[model samples]
Target: MKDFIFESTPKIVFGAGSIAYLVRELNILKKKSAFFICDPVIEKTIFFNDLSGKLKKEGFIVNIFSEIVPDPDFDSCDMARDAIVAAGSDIVIGIGGGSAMDIAKVAAITAKNRKKAKDLVKNPELCEPGMPLVLIPTTAGTGSEVTHIGIFSDNDEKLKTGIVSPYLYADVAILDPEITVSMPETVTAHSGTDAIIHALEALTSKLATPFTDLLAEEALGILYRNILPAFEDGNNIEARSNMLYGSMLAGKAFANSSVAAIHAFAYPIGAEFHIPHGLANSIMLIPVLKFNLNSDIEKYCRAARAIGVQTTGLSEAEILNRLLFKLEFLLDRLKIKRSLGYYGVTESDIPRLALSVMKVTRLLSNNPGEVLLEDAERLYREAM
Candidate 1:
């Protein structure tokens, strides 16, 4: 056991129809005007139109910013900040996947704190608290709503960068599985896989404490059992709801304990290849887990059992072997691309990508296993 402190969003409203709770949270914050941020696709959806309509009907001034792209850039984030300023938004309501929520987080903070998105990336310690933010997830993964860490693409540096500060925490997070019911099959698989990896990495992070392990352990059970069900039947509300809850639990766990080298390895490939974050993490998970297993056999074995693997009477090696096979089977079932080679990454590119992983000390430092430059190169090679 170690001394630790846990922090999460102040308020979390969860369940099937919990999107309706947003207005009440807004009332508590006493914010009459909201800047609603989402991707252009979401803005065009019936769900977005209806939700925003409800806000307007309640006499709340609503402004829409729909310019967010996948793997959001700071330029887009800066534009969002300006949009909030122009709209005179009292709160920022982010309603979509990770990218949209990340932009909304930036817009909220910069709109009030007089800081640019890039400044937060560079000097997160200097970040000041911003306007109240309410996050609504239309996807069952990412866990962005409950996390203080925000990731964005730095196109100038050609890598993904993270900003970590308590100031980035949302005031309210609405986990409404009903909103995720309409998610496309591929999106469901990708997002759920990301949450699964979040739990897995957090379990073995050096900063992991007993409190975080409890949440991550339960999260693994819920996520592993429900991800396939949600993917196979998007209309299954029970499965969807459990998946959302699992994602949030994992978010809270990782928010305190932090994620390890899997994320560090994922970031470089995601930025370079334009792969979505979840999918990139999915690709890297098995390889990094294989590398980390020997570093903490007991915890890794517990992780296997947490995900429903029956490991009674099994040796540690056998437990790890079973976990790997189960992960591979799940990836196959979801049609996840398991090879970096499939995405056109080659042995020649390994050096450059591994170099980028070394720069993510924010995540790598927390890995249970010590990851060096050579280890990074080898892991990427294994993924290929």
Candidate 2:
């Protein structure tokens, strides 16, 4: 086994009714004021209103910044940090999907350190732990709640960059299945696909450790079995709970082991085209899997089995082929039609996207196989 180190800070509280514990957790942390970061859609939800009301009733002054946009940018982080400082909040709570959580994580650091988001992006280690932070995930994907990496788009560059440091990990993570019950069917499918991809990529990453492998395997299994049921019936509390738990495990695994080429390629698509991160990941999944297959056949086969593919009687090549087919089928079943062309991506756009992929060497270095510029261009073409 290769040498490896593991560390995480989030104390996870998980269950169907775990949102009720937010007040208790804040009290334990002695937090008197809160700055909530969330998407505008979530801000209008009854669930969010009720939760905000309860926190106010408990004597915790709450200020909400609900301008969080998808594929959040550095400017948004700066805005959120300004809000946190202006509110004089003692705690920062992120209460939605990856975008909300990511902004909150970086804003917390920026608020306390009094630094620019761009400066911190250039040197993630400069980010000091800031304010009491609580992350409540309303989506079962991204695993942003337990991760130490916060991703955002760089508008000037038209690509995504991540601030990766232990300081970004949440102090507490509350996973309440009831909150996810309101997800639209498309959100459920895309988010679930993202979680599964996290496990798969982590398992195949060059930094994969025994500890991460164990978590990734179980996460894959749970996600494979429950994603469809959850997508089909949004109100299935049991399925929703399992998906959330599995996503958190996947997040933990990837946080330690790291994700690789798929994420590297997905970043540009999301940043440039406004594609949802989960959907961008799904579009690139099979192409990148094929690229990495030759690097570690055994690991890929194990991943196939982990996702519930039967490999008992198949050769390595057959198993890999079957696994690819199964993934394609899953995407179709989940109503994720495969084709970049469907999303308005053209052959002329491949070069720019490939160049963008090259810039994400942070993620590319974790890939088990070498991904050259030509390989990236080919992957984009294949995705199309």
| Each candidate: RMSD | 1.1, 1.0
- Please provide, for model 1 over 283-356, each residue's C-alpha lDDT reduced to its tens digit, 9 standing for 90 to 100: 99888988899999988998999988898798889999999999889999999987999998889999999899
lDDT of 2 at 19: 93
Query: How does model 2 score by TM-score?
Result: 0.98
Q: Where in model 1 is the C-alpha error above 4 Å?
A: none
Pairs with steric clashes in candidate 1: none
lDDT of 2 by residue, 1-384 (tens): 778889775498989889999999998899899899998999999989999999898888999999987888899999999999999999999999999999999899999999988988778776667777999999999899999899989999999998887888899999999999999999999999999999999998988999999999999999999999999999999999999999999999999998999999999998988889999999999999999999999899999899778888889999999889888889999999768888889999999999989999898999989999999999999999
lDDT values of the candidates?
0.90, 0.92
**Model 1 misses residue 169 by how many Å?**
0.7
